[model samples]
Target: MDCASRKFYHKHEFDCRDFLEKYCADKPDMEFAEDALQFPTMSFHYVFSSGFVKGDVLIDISMGPLIHHLYSACDIFKDIIILKLNEGCNMETSRWANTRTGAFEWRHTSAYVSKLEGKSAQIQDKEMKLKEAISHIICCDFENENITHPVVLPLADCITSIWILDAISKDEDEYMKNLEKVSKLLRPGGHLILIAALNTTFFMTGGERIYILKHDANFVINALSKVGFVIEYYAVQMRRNDSTLIDYEGVMFFTFRKTK
Candidate 1:
């Protein structure tokens, strides 16, 4: 995104609402819109209690509405490290993450993750802005030369994975592989907070679409344990509004502590 008046490069992002209302609204869909509107509350809870601060490195797989909260969240944190994994992402949010006081910006793009598709819905909201600051760096996807297996780097005080896990693999092994790769980013005792759509086979919102393997809370917990994360807190919701015919995501938010 250009600084003066702003012109973002990645213009084609999947709209969040379009996905929520389409395939996901069927039975065990997610209320991504409502949850997105609650960005203030969720960010407050995660940043405050989850130990996110100016020094934390947040390596997120996707940059859609899953990050809508961060549009405003950039206010409280600096030294932010982002692994965007796609180029046509919301540069506006990157600007917000950059301009905020003390917040340094960084990005990593990967086509493999983009192959995961539905990356656009990750940052669907247009309202996100930089209240104060510019990112430190933004890198397009580069090749990984070493480590056939996922690396475990102690690069951040906290690590977060939201909505990306389920979509990564329905096959247990592949999903676990992604989790292991993500765990390398955090130090032991560091926190990992995640929000994922549950019991979902497929969903659509804002002209963007996504697919899932249809798992539940227990499946996630077991996977975390295998990857050396201890479940600290977890919650799942599957309720439909009487006025609305749709049933929102049996969403699950889990907080885990890295235990050596």
Candidate 2:
């Protein structure tokens, strides 16, 4: 596929519902579930349970309106703010948050987290806590100086960005610049839990091929270092499924602390 022919997430109209159905749905037959839903949810649960991330406020800048990654976070953070690149995503998330009709079901994901926490019976309670923890869902512009513009948000104690940088960035320079912009959202000494898809060029979603910056772990480590973030933990999970939805070799998870 021609790279130029691919759709850019920032320029395209993302179908949030379609995205959920394709990657995040609870169907046992979904090919992308292991990578899209399980890997992130499990990694997050472990990160929070192991005492690696502790914060009163967490800001999530992830692709789509996915909340599976935030299940464990709700237990650790008092406030959770989600920043999306478009209003559609924000509205989709609000639907789930408010328990509106036709919202994508996340109980399976939450149940997985609960099982990891050894409280499988408290799945409902876990979901309730996460809903209550989400304080705001605001639209943001990564290219703007003030990502959230007009609404100055409190510096977060930790920020979680999952598969967002690669999806929106057109090249390495833009990726680095966006990384710098995201770093400013954290206060000094705050942690950033970042997850990236390794060497993925494009992902098929909503019946369209979306572009992803094809990069490796070394580039990410160097970028984090240059942005004054000290990497404390890094792990890579090799791709488990042989799905053509996305050609990611593996998923890389990093825990970094801001030094300045």
Candidate 3:
């Protein structure tokens, strides 16, 4: 399966300020309780506070340059391996991790995560910690099922996949196959922290439209269970349909333990 997409991730402005100003606030489209703010805030709350297993390695198989989901895993895992589907995304994330000049700045995102955890005054400190925690960034593909290629890397204690399957799979069958590939990289009983946009058909990046799998919470739950994941925690934030910026009906986040 060819995972390449014509639309590149670097073309989009995933700026922290822009994201915060647009979706994180309580607007006419989103209420205070069910706004997009819940993703980052609640993700942090769940991973750190829910007795989730912490170990030597954590793999983040993100579809784009976004690293907001990595905030919670930084402190918990000793080594954070960011595996990207393309070179552009790999370089983008690595640039940020290495503090390179002109890197897509995420200090604001780090600051917000800190503020959510009652450490509002320690924004810079959080950024530094996240940078240190990230060990490497490399190219990987879910379809290949050999994410590390010639070198077989050690199985990770946990895997965090956010909005990746929707971007890669054309249908539920392919989605389930990709899920199995991801499951192979985790140790038995390891945790899988997944987040996805519900009922999303497409997303715009760099003026180009990218198709996505339109699935709801039940689809994700059933898929995970069939793939031998025991559901531990699940939640969803119903997306308000008033915004044209992104067309998604809702957001779903869940944590599951690999049963076999």
Candidate 4:
């Protein structure tokens, strides 16, 4: 099955506002290290806020229209290019970036992240920065592994993808292969921020079951190592027992830097 044809983003309500409300509104009982959403945001904030791990360009591969992770990137990088699998995700993202009314509002998410970073009053300010930093929303094919082929894009200084491989891959082999292929987009010594669901095979959205490639921490660690990345930070948040939402044991966030 063509991964793009699955149209998960089209059916799912994956707006940033919905994501924050559903997964991040309430503080987790566990420490920051054990909270999936919080951990990723905090880790990103800590790293990028330090003025380290920054570059002129950051490319987001298979981003699926989610800008939650871009909060920190916008502050650290001068330009952001978002590459997605299909047009639907691109359209939705463009709507939000261009501030079209009725588009999913993400000011709340910006405000929350500002609060996390001790800049509670800079919510609107950060939103404006995010809007300015995002320079492009283009389509790319992960399976092809030639994201900017025929017209190569400037090598990215950092790449961030969240649950993109699992959501699109048919199996572990495909997932690993795609990971290596996508990692090529980064320049040597560039950073990679990855967030994935642990041991999850499926998620529900719009009354439909969306299948994903099941994977665990060991698999991901080995996969990245094999593809010339060194892990810098790793964390996971155990999933709460919820029959109503997705069934996954946990969410894992990993920060890696390309070595070769």
- Top candidate on TM-score is 2
Q: Mind giving the per-residue lDDT tens digits that candidate 2 earns over 1-260?
A: 56577798877978888888888888868887777778888888888888867879999999999888999999899999999998888999999999999888999998998998999999999999999999999999987988999889999999999889999888899988999989999999999998999989988878888899999989999999998999988888889888888899999988899999
The lDDT values for all models are: 0.47, 0.89, 0.73, 0.74
Candidate 2 lDDT (Cα, 0 to 1): 0.89
- Model 1 alpha-carbon miss at residue 125, Å: 19
Q: Write the per-residue lDDT of candidate 3 for residues 143-244, one digit (tens) a residue.
A: 466857865778989998878877777779988998998898899989998888879877654445666788988899899999899888887877755656
Selected candidate, larger lDDT, 3 vs 4: 4
Q: Write candidate 1's Cα lDDT for 1-260 as tens digits.
A: 12232211122344533432332232344433334324323443455444433344544444342343344334444444455434323343354444454222212111112222334343322123222222332432322321122433336656555566665454577677767767766777777767766676544435333445567888888998987888877766554332232233566777777886
* Greater-TM-score candidate between 2 and 3: 2
Candidates, ranked, TM-score: 2, 4, 3, 1
Residue pairs with clashing backbones, model 2: none
RMSD of 2: 1.3
Number of clashing residue pairs, candidate 4? 0
**Clash number for each model:** 28, 0, 0, 0
Segments in model 4 whose C-alpha atoms lie over 4 Å from true places = 1-37, 241-243
TM-score for all models, in order of appearance: 0.60, 0.97, 0.85, 0.85
Estimate the lDDT of model 3: 0.73
Q: Deviation in angstroms for 209 in model 1?
A: 3.9
Candidate 4 achieves a global lDDT of 0.74
